[model samples]
Target chain A: MATHRFDPNFTDNVINSMGPKTSPRLRQLMTGLIKHVHDFARENELTVDEWMAGVKLLNWAGQMSDDKRNEGQLVCDVIGLESLVDEITFTLADEAKDAPTATAILGPFFRADTPYRENGADIVVTKPKDGEMAFMHGRVMDFETKTPLVGATVEVWQASTNGLYEQQDENQVEFNLRGKFKTDADGRYYFYCLRPTPYPVPDDGPAGRMLQLMDRHPFRPAHIHIIATHDGYRPLTTQIFDRKDKYLDNDSVFAVKDSLVVDFVERKDDPQAGLELNYDVKLVADAK
Target chain B: MATHRFDPNFTDNVINSMGPKTSPRLRQLMTGLIKHVHDFARENELTVDEWMAGVKLLNWAGQMSDDKRNEGQLVCDVIGLESLVDEITFTLADEAKDAPTATAILGPFFRADTPYRENGADIVVTKPKDGEMAFMHGRVMDFETKTPLVGATVEVWQASTNGLYEQQDENQVEFNLRGKFKTDADGRYYFYCLRPTPYPVPDDGPAGRMLQLMDRHPFRPAHIHIIATHDGYRPLTTQIFDRKDKYLDNDSVFAVKDSLVVDFVERKDDPQAGLELNYDVKLVADAK
Candidate 1:
């Protein structure tokens, strides 16, 4: 017998065989995804055995995720897919100037809303034993015009003194070291809270294991999380890392920026600032 | 002053943080995605320097693709994402028994519909001036019952005697050695053609370059393309390969199977067989 030949558009036939029209967007997405995926199979000359192993890895990734934790996201970040998408979204805003604030990944720890309080308030109502007190103040303004954005809202949050988000540690207060403050007529708002310390993202997950297997480190630098907003301004999601932290250059979330780094000045017993120490912030409005 | 903490589900504030309420799905996807992306940044301690390099890589992958090729797919495939999705879809089929024929990637060469033809006809109407004539025969069947599937239509195509798909070789005849054949009453189909030798997938593309960089090979095993179908029975889109080919176990497309490998016996002069070749095909209704 000679080689009997034929065309095998197996992929198109199979996908088309799935029936009914899909939205152009979704179709384009799936099609593009499929092409890349299939091309990969061809390019690697992937064997059946190797293909099966990939399936098992994904299953393990899924198993590592739960209500209290999601390891899948961590894996995505490590593999660079998360950053790729973030870069895309970040670019949608104006690129001419420094982003009003450093736009960074909103780490897995954020929960919606902190209680709103008047200016010059504290977020750490019940202080956890571990972290120190830091009084933070910030004013929101248009980056180009340098005009203060009065009535702007600034939400601040941080891990408990034990170096964990409230959700991650059952022992911590429900929303410890987290609060919402609105700027006064001068576009200034202040809040006091326990200082954040370097913490490790859950290393028990598949992502952590991969990092370990790959010999990559997992510590994130200390940082205060903030989301600032004002009318006609693009909301800014950012973090302020301690300049002295060891992992500042390697903040696992890749959120650090030169301008966003702040010194946690020590004021042993300064009561005039209403707390043991004071920190100041200059906010830039989210632009169109 | 103190940090004012609130409930984990601080509806009034965090809710207000997101301008317009997103659909539950969008919210879930975005939040999960954001967290993971941010986490990756944190874990890698990714700095602005490294982030720029990543952006550059993505741009390169994108620029590598064009109308005649898809490099992005190749990159994703090598990373195992393509196989992950393929396996997921395979496992999630409505019924394991209803699986369609083992589907593989449609290489970039496929161009819509090839010219259709009649039953028991030769597809390679014009053979390479230097290649030897060979006769191929096969029968389409229901794999589960091992019964002949009469009246089934089989469409076939392949690269010319040189072993290059039509789109890739401008020197070869357009739609060369490509045609369709309907299975006879006895479920047998035969055609006159030359043996197809093993060939390399396009290596000038990004996938090829990546393979080169990774020290991987690009050769696909010798195989004949065939698609068998009949109404009421699932369509079979598959290929039969010569077992002796060097790339059998390492098909770039991951398309080979134990059952798909068929021996191509060498035949001497036999005028009665009209080119001295015998071929048979065995097929099953596209797996449920």
Candidate 2:
């Protein structure tokens, strides 16, 4: 057996141990992070067994993640960490009535290298028998000048009406419900695809268990994910949530921003289109 | 793109969302944990990419752990989370001069079902050519009564002189340097094994990279781990640290305590033994 002593300066000792070569940002980040984590554990009198349980849960999350899924980010999302961080980073401190549309959680399902499509092209590779046709048209404009930003690229993705992303459904073809469209001379982008439906996050992993413990539902409101970029404007990664979805107010990831919510309208002219959304994007200039 | 609004009650919202069915303790723990983690992120104004990188790092740590090694715990160890928690949980609020000896981290290497050995038995299976033999004798007693605790089990384990625990080295025999011995009627336990040498934590993983970034060394000082348990008393998991080790003050795990330090003396009687150590133990009865 051994004796014990309280290190009155345990936090300082750890923070100071950082090598002089460490960048100031890294040191500051680690110092704050460690202080918070240590304070939490100490204040709670966290036991070794309880701490080990957390380690095991994290391990389970890692084991459950792969190219098609990321349980790691899901853990953060379910805990409100991803949303909180999104708020902290994307929200301008200035109280500017308008900035570029606020960003949203990219989530774990975004796929890179999606195929580019011409305006009005369909991203639906294999539409469900009961799926409704939906069209979205939008213009990208500078927030301050209210002027068009020509030739912007709007990369878009969404789950199917059946509530599954391409990677999660083998019936859907490669890059299903995903496309990148370039704005026309009017700075207007146009495309059509199946309307997305609310779906549950993968509920077999650690986040699922966490939700179960918290007695919270695991559903995210139906939404379209977008990454809009122009030559001199700040790039945006965000989601357009369906205003009618029941889960919007209680989104499992807490990522619903009222501005990002849009109501679907009945298609008036195109017999092929069952619904339509007309949403415009506002962009902020890049920081110097 | 859509609109945005700041939930002034973001932190409180998250804390209040916990279900009524959740155990009070779990709710409290989660609330505190989420508060600290959220406050840290918000205060730092961590960018999305930086937050994602941290998530990826935690995932990497999880991926590096398995049945034989746990990088999750190691991450906590190097950052002093585990040590801080140990101090908070095990350190009594009262200033009692005499209590049971203190505890140390039961690092990832501990295995169940270790073979039991008779008193004076050896744990070293295949010693290194330059390895020195060492013997340890210990007595377990009641802290308040100063009376012997007979028939108690003292479970001990150590890395070989080569600084590799059996599980980490394929060349080492099964359960090498691991054994449990029962104390005699006098509350004394005895065993002989190879002297442990300073060893580095597995540094090929995320924790390793963290240490590298922090400009910190990864080596823990030489020490023997023990878990002493008896019926009707609190169990004790602790360490006997080699006093002469250079890293004693800067142990990589921050586990070194003044009372746990012991000097190894030259063996006078046994030509087969290179060093000898005698450490006693004290136990506090379990609380009612």
Candidate 3:
């Protein structure tokens, strides 16, 4: 066999050879990826055992993901990668940073084709409710003009008080705690559901094990997911966090933006014996 | 919900909370990983779409790996991460850097329990061999003392001229071109097999697609893998490359070290119609 030496130019040689004819975008992305990944391994002086362990982790994460669960997304979340990407992609102009509603991660639990309900309709389809009832009322408006956006579709979903989404808990009815509402003439939308409560993300997979190994909790702050869309306006996907939830200070997903937090007012005299939450969403107009 | 602000401290808060009680090694690994991943996203201004693309790639890589295939390992190889890790983990002391045999990646194709063959025995188990025959002879010695090590187990395996290992090509017999041999008293060992040839890595999976997208070729240079172990010496796993191979300078896996390259001498008068190769291995002793 021929004997060759180990030179420092190995990385550049590999990069140059691998990206000769790729599209400019792909070339740029691959170049950055190669440099960062190579630098990361060298800087850490990573061992073969560590590399193999990572391989196993990735394999486990892939094998654990399915229609109802996405461990890869969870991996990104646990490492704060998703949040960083969101910050980079959604950072608003200095003057409008606080004007528009802050965006958060579109977590793995979201589902499409949710049933649409009328304003003030109850979305808790499960029988014999086990958690405190709550009403969430909100308005959707154009960011700059503050004009109500009538006919805006407000899609909402959240985990039950027990910390499990409807799809994750077999006992809950299909589409439980999930529904869509259309804004009325005044750009108002309302729905009745259980109060949001802090709940642990699924801890049965590699992602959960990763959290355990890191000495970190898997709980996300009590929050309601919202995706609002209207013609001529950019879609807004965010979560409204309950300020009192303990996990807010250390959300496992790093998705807690201050502007996305709000109060859940206790109403002891209400017939529903639950809390009331009011939130307003401001969305940017879609660029022409 | 309570109106909270988007604090810039979120990343630090998560990092601090997640690593308090972990082992020092785990803490360091996690800390560096979190920081680099976050920085990569932020520096590149990674978009949500781009992040999702990454997630999809990871998912595909994971799902594509199995008993006979390892897409994750291939992903690392393509990104130059495995080579970097190997470099860091196996780097020799400055004084002896050039004295010892160089190490290479233990690729996904390596399998344990290969059958042992006697010295000068042919490892090719297939009938009517299509490629020219070759003989590989080498000696094992201590790096500093230059003393031969007897009874050293030298395991060897390589793809056929068609660029497929026995396991990857079912038409070939089990353990074809794979054997383990013990060195003689003089630390000499020899085996007969087909000449190695450059072949493309498996491209039917996500890893292959990644290479195609990046316009990168998957062909590794013509080479043979060797793993030698002895009683009082550290095990060495490496590959010897054929210097004349077209892909020598651009091995798809980035595993070509300068010292691991060698000549495949053609013997025109040999009845077997093959080439001869000679390589000497220098091993580092096990720590006392």
State which candidate has the highest DockQ: 2
Tens-digit lDDT track of model 3 for A86-158: 7767773323445478888899999986889889888887844568788888799998899999999999998
After superposing candidate 1 on the true structure, give the runs of residues whose Cα lies further than 4 Å from its correct spot: A1-28, A39-53, A63-68, A96-98, A268-288, B1-288
Which candidate's lDDT is highest?
2
In model 3, state the lDDT of residue B110. Answer: 89
Model 3, B86-182: lDDT tens per residue?
A: 8877873324445578889999888887988999888877843568788889899998899999999999999987889888998889899899999
Error (Å) of candidate 2 at residue B119 is: 1.9
Q: Of the candidates numbered 1 and 3, which has the greater lDDT value? A: 3
For every model shown, the clashing-pair count is 39, 4, 24
Cα deviation of A35, candidate 2, in Å: 0.9
Question: Over the full model, what C-alpha lDDT does candidate 2 score relative to the true structure?
Answer: 0.84
TM-score of each: 0.49, 0.94, 0.93
Which structure is stronger by TM-score: 1 or 3?
3
Candidate 1 has what TM-score?
A: 0.49
Per-residue lDDT tens digits of candidate 1, residues B1-288? 212221112222212223244455434433443433443443333444345444333334445555444555554443334434444444344245644356444344555567666655566665667665567777777757768888877776666656677656777677777777778888887777666678776666545654454445666777777766776575545567777788886666556666667766666674422343354544444443
Q: What is the TM-score of chain A in candidate 3?
A: 0.92
lDDT of each: 0.58, 0.84, 0.82
RMSD per candidate (Å) reads 17.8, 3.6, 4.1
TM-score of chain B of each: 0.70, 0.94, 0.92
Poorest 10 consecutive residues of model 1 chain B by lDDT? B1-10
